[model samples]
Target: MKTIKILLSFALTATLFTSCYTEVVVDDFAYVDEPTISLNQLLRSHELWYVDINSTLGYGETPFLQKAFTVSFINGVVYANNNIAGLGANGDGFGIDVGEYNAYENILDVYHDIDGFSTFDVYEIDYNTIELYNPNNDTSYFLDGYQRNNFDYDFVFYDNIHYFLQEYEAWEKTYTSEYGAINEFDNENYLQFLAGGNDSTFRSSQDDTGINANNLYWDYTGVYGVGDVYGDAYLKTLTLDYDYLGNEYFELSVINDGKIELFHPSSETVYEFEGRGYIQYLKSESGTKKEKVQSDKLRKQRKDKVANPRENTRKV
Candidate 1:
């Protein structure tokens, strides 16, 4: 009789363990609550423009004389320009003129306002040539007029303009993202939905069904253009389920520009605002500049040492 009782107890324990260890396989076709917030709404809510004044030079001794400007983007191209001008009206200054190369090439007599001073007869040259000019002091610099067949100033100008526009677009996209996040928090239904989930996921989509899991399974086909808002046609998916206490846990995914991104609710990745080039390309440009600067500094230092070897040795 004791053996029979022990066997029955063991059977009951095994049954309990089996029940607890069973895994629930959610059907691929199972229905999940659709996201109330649209992808456009999310992007618009979190939209932001991260502006940084890289280097600012003023107009004169007190304010500054020359200024360089650069605008970086996350989704768009980067634009950069150097403002060349003098301190006073009588002082020499540089002017920029962008037009059809044929018409504007010989017409170096461009006009513009430099620090509130209206000046005429500004010179127009290829950006490459302009890069060689010194902005600090008055120096006579000239661009060798190239044959029409040999030079493509129009192409260069177009490229520069395109780069600047790209940077502007990036700023706009960032601003939209920041605004969207703020709006998401303010929406009562969205917040409640978020709070109720134990494991919630969010993703951007274009499908109208508003289901999160479907978005994951579906092939992403949304193509974002410049200045496109998140909600215009694109959609966002949020997947979530609540624990016993109803604390929310969620996952987010969005179709940004052209790519689909899966992001954690708590962790957001902000790429450094680098313009439209790979790290290798940027590194190459930066490396070249660094090398040039170092070479120049070394040359100066070597000259000093040669001039006064004893004095230089003591300082070193």
Candidate 2:
């Protein structure tokens, strides 16, 4: 009888071990229809960009249309930014956001920190492609196939101009005219280029009270967004846009960094105000610390090296 009992106990123990092993197997192979992605692991190394809106709910002026999107995951948290022109309904679509995510039961729950936003679900993630349904979206996917940006810099020339202006309240112009008329400039008594949003702001000096000539502040106004172009000019020279009369104009070959060399030649607009002079936005040393400098210098060096080629081959 004792021997029989021992055999039964051994059989029961073996069965229990088999059951535990079966549970682990089921855990890994639990979801069959969709791939089981370890969400935390995948998000750490990869990011997503919007390929296009999903074509399920029919398309006509959807929010994600023609808009850029980038989603990043860091330390179990998510951050996103949209470059939509008029961001979301009532300006809700623009700006940066921090959010959280949880993957459970074959679903991804995204919780945005912005108000008037609802928790969204990600139903499927296929390789680099993703399927999501935003409450704002008429169909699944606020965007699809969000890929990584290995060189993730959303910076444009306009952004650079904005930051440079925001850093300094007043600026000085030291320029050389084509005829050597406006070459001599003083740092203390500088031109009044009051930096305002969306246009060429009124001109003012350090002692200028209002946007006028009480302290030699001219009426150099800019009707912004109408003539602002941010791109490279011919021969890789970065340019800025200025307006004259009812026509649009681009100040080509204007060297604009922290210190600007305003050498664009046009007798009508502000380009010829000093006839090819340099303008420097004066700021506290701490303020202009991070501004990118000497890019034009590097550009010149490359041009010179090409123009006057040199070879370093010694006594061979």
Candidate 3:
């Protein structure tokens, strides 16, 4: 009877121990009630996250997030595509390494080489959409995840053509088609698009400055803008608002890496401009300008051909 009681007690103790161990294993390791996918896995799943700046809802801005057109997360490294000039070709399409990041649960902690540390609450909006909300700044930025194999780089390039114009110090008149009628634009030789203080700022020069941006004499300063042509991605309309000469509109086309063609609809002439003094932004890991060749020449109004009334060639 004593042996029987001892055996029964041993069996009961073993059963209790086994039950406790199994419960811990299920709770800690196989907790199905919680999300199975880790934050690291979710971030690493996409090759690129296109920062939808227009969708952003907040007054405060994130430095890194504000500058990046697209960002990528790969093996704890953060990559960003800041400029549109070399969109598909830079950093093998992943862009330059801006910083490093760590993921935990639904939070992402980034240590940018330039902007320092920033934390974001990662919320998965859908299968390919995520909202990165910065609690410190009360700002939320939406990102659309995409795989490299199916990404449309041309669309992105055309969508952000304004930034592309500002990449160069100046654009020199390189070629002009003999097809269009002669007009006052023939007197123009150089065009410079600026980035800051209202992105549409522009300066024009009639002097044959060649490829030297410093030697160029700006004759006119006004506003310039790039607009879409009836929701078309490939076609864009450019408007140069000259204060005295009115607005000059043209059909803008990027001929190549360093050349752009402008079609004047009224004169039916084609003008090709070559980029001079390229300015590559964020060339280093710490977000520094790579090659900036600024023109400090004095800006003045052009005295020649000021009588040509502004004509509405096409509606932007």
In Å, residue 9's CA in model 2 sits off its true spot by 43
Could you give candidate 3's per-residue lDDT for residues 137-208 as a string of tens digits?
767778999987788989988988887888888899988897879999988999999875567799999996
- Backbone clashes, each candidate: 43, 9, 1
Residue-level lDDT for 72 in candidate 2: 57
Q: What's the candidate order when arranged by decreasing TM-score?
A: 3, 2, 1
lDDT of each: 0.23, 0.36, 0.80
Candidate 2 accuracy as lDDT: 0.36
- Once superposed on the true structure, which residue ranges of model 1 sit more than 4 Å away at CA? 1-111, 114-136, 147-149, 153-316
Please give the range of 10 consecutive residues that has the lowest summed lDDT in model 1: 293-302
Residue-level lDDT of model 1, residues 1-316, one tens digit each, is 9999999999999998777665322332233434334322322222121111211112211011122221111122111122111101101111111111111221122111222221111132332221111232222122232222343333332222212222211111121134223422121111111101221222122223323321223222122112222553232323332333232222222332222232224434211111221111011242231111111110000011111111111111
Residue-level lDDT for 313 in candidate 2: 23
TM-score of each model, in listed order: 0.17, 0.39, 0.78
lDDT tens digits by residue: candidate 2, 1-316: 9999999999999999999999988876766635545655555435544424323332222222212244555664554433322112211222233456675543455554432233334544555655454444333433443333332233323333433332333444444344523321211233333333332443323332233223354334433321234453221222222354342332433243334443333432233122112222111244222112211110000011111111212223
